[model samples]
Target: MWGPSFSLRDRDRMLEGEWHTIRLASSKKEKVEEEGSMRVFMEHMKALEDKSIGFKFHTIANEECVDHYVVADETETGEYSVEYDGHNKFTLFDADPGAYAIFDLTNFKDGKSFNLVALYAREPDVSQEIKNKFEELREKHGIPKENMVDLTQAVGLIPERVLVPTLQIPVATLEKEETPDPPVLSGDFSPGLQHHPFLSTHHPATSSHI
Candidate 1:
């Protein structure tokens, strides 16, 4: 059985038990003109100015589900527990409504490769390349362009140092064991958020494992 959110078709390309590093290329935002204008605008924005993100996937329960982790940087980390339907797409429940990330695996002359592009429900700036790719995927999925947001503003510059967190799973016991609980985001799991325009807050403790 597959998870309600993910598809099985992407399993072959998105190998489990492996880690992939994603380097930011560019960032921009989309603007829509008047209803009849049919004109769209893209504005570039900066966040995570110099950071490298990390992703890791692990199949659980005979491939019925997956436990994934997103390491925003050395200080912040978020865990995603999702079901696998296919096509390397997994629904994220924790994001702000209508926001999710797609793990796209591309094959190049060098070999197979993978990258993640996030779709936000709100309006945010992103790069042209990312916007175009996002539009194509949105159309393929039959999602309305107006309902989607480009939240990849932090995906362009590479940081000097990158840190990938290790996964932590509960050990099995001989007796009947209770199901493991879903992973939770640490207090400092805010990605691409450095200085807030409204309120100032203190950074939280760093916890690597879920």
Candidate 2:
């Protein structure tokens, strides 16, 4: 089974909480219906960022929308856990044994330094420079590009806003009610695989803005 290996620098950059916006630039689709569904999925992500909303990626096994899981124990090689959440949701890796890439993007926003993460299943249809980087990693791992998916163009990042509430909601009141779970993918989702449920079209809407 092929898995993505990230350098220490790359891992640190991803764990850093400097990114604000994310976009879906591309995905893997085998049919016209899948393509349509992917478009809707991209639109939903855009809507979430526009509204400054956040989501959690549930990694528990057998749960719906469990697209990825974290290897709780690290190996002697110092490989961190393979997990995804609102913070590292864009960080891509194969939930199963497959080829993947863990890379970094350094950009300046408003004169402040920030980083973006791009995870690819296969080589992306990007510039020669970017392709070269992916190629180097592929060669190092001896993984063929044919087995990977080009998700580079399918996703992107934008600015994000941090909100700090002045007043805290009472814990007693909050605990009195149960919050509904995020929607799960119905038609195309695999039974045992982890999924990004926040990308579902059935996500709730809000009038709030960042």
Candidate 3:
């Protein structure tokens, strides 16, 4: 099936974030509808959308809106080879992550349209990391953990040269739970804040931010 591909354009870095665009590339192969492959790509993006909007507000807020990431177009390729069993197995693939660019279309109260930071393979090392201690903290504090690590890595397994549509996530109807903080014992001093440095501050604040 036809899909979309994106070419990364320019991006700007901010102290807090960045913005970039993936230029609309070409379309996928014409003869086959690789539904399984396309679905795999879609699921990967949906996972990202989920994490990006997981934050809770301190006070009551307006209805949460979703960020828009769409597929402008896509391109794909495939090949088949004879196996030792005297049968041919065909493998299909795509190169584009999406057509045009994936972006958040929300208009903020400030009247600015949502700006997106585009990341590409050739872009400088714009990636970040988080420490295991953050996971430890999540476990210790009884905070529900997100399986983002597994999800993000899974997206890479999708072959290239195809532009899957940008994944969409609705404003999740979050159950507001007043999670009480665990008791902090003042007397359990360990001389210094040994665990603070390894607190994994680099963890993604939201999935979209990744």
Candidate 4:
């Protein structure tokens, strides 16, 4: 819901129609209670082996989907849940204790703010050992334990430009032609004559001798 992924200054690619499995952790009493209560319910869902994940793409131009998801609550029965707002947030329940697999759906309206919403994957019967390992990896990577959202799917939209062989021009052809320098100004020229300035009167040739 909030993290480095949301703060990225770049546009991320949209990945929809992709499924994943994840591990999630929570320390809140209510969340812990829910985890215990919902454990059995989660296992009932179809088993999803593919851990590959992805993000749902969105923009200001298309906001209807986010609006609907925010207001609407679909019963996923531990499979998934959607949180509503200016953007949509979804959570899946697939992970060992203290961990949950996350599926993020982002609506890039601000290109700032919390533009991304995350949902968790649903998987029951996660062992404590697995959960510990998940936490270990997260800590090793300096990942935040709170408000965590994984962006395994939000890759760069534009591919890197490729370097291809090109036709070469001869060195002589590539050389630029020399440009002539401008003529320098000198005091030999009369400023008034060059500018054709207005003259009030031409005094009669003053004869110094006369």
TM-score of each: 0.23, 0.28, 0.17, 0.21
Per-residue lDDT of candidate 1, residues 1-210 (tens digit): 122244322332222222222111111112111111101111221112223233433222221222333332221222222212211323322121222223322112233322233333223433455356455654554545454433234321221121111122335652467667989756865645354432322322221221
**Using TM-score as the measure, what is the rank order of every candidate, best first?**
2, 1, 4, 3
Q: How high is the lDDT of residue 183 in model 2? A: 93
In the order shown, the candidates' Cα RMSDs to the true structure are 20.9, 19.9, 22.3, 27.9
Give the Å error, residue 65, model 1: 27
Worst ten-residue run, lDDT, model 4?
Answer: 61-70
Whole-model lDDT values for every prediction: 0.29, 0.30, 0.22, 0.29
Question: lDDT of candidate 1 vs native?
Answer: 0.29
lDDT of 2 by residue, 87-165 (tens): 1122222211122334432333344432333343322233455455555544454444443344334322220111113
Two-way lDDT contest, 2 vs 3, winner: 2
What lDDT does model 3 reach? 0.22
Specify the highest-TM-score model's number: 2
Candidate 3, RMSD to the unseen true structure: 22.3
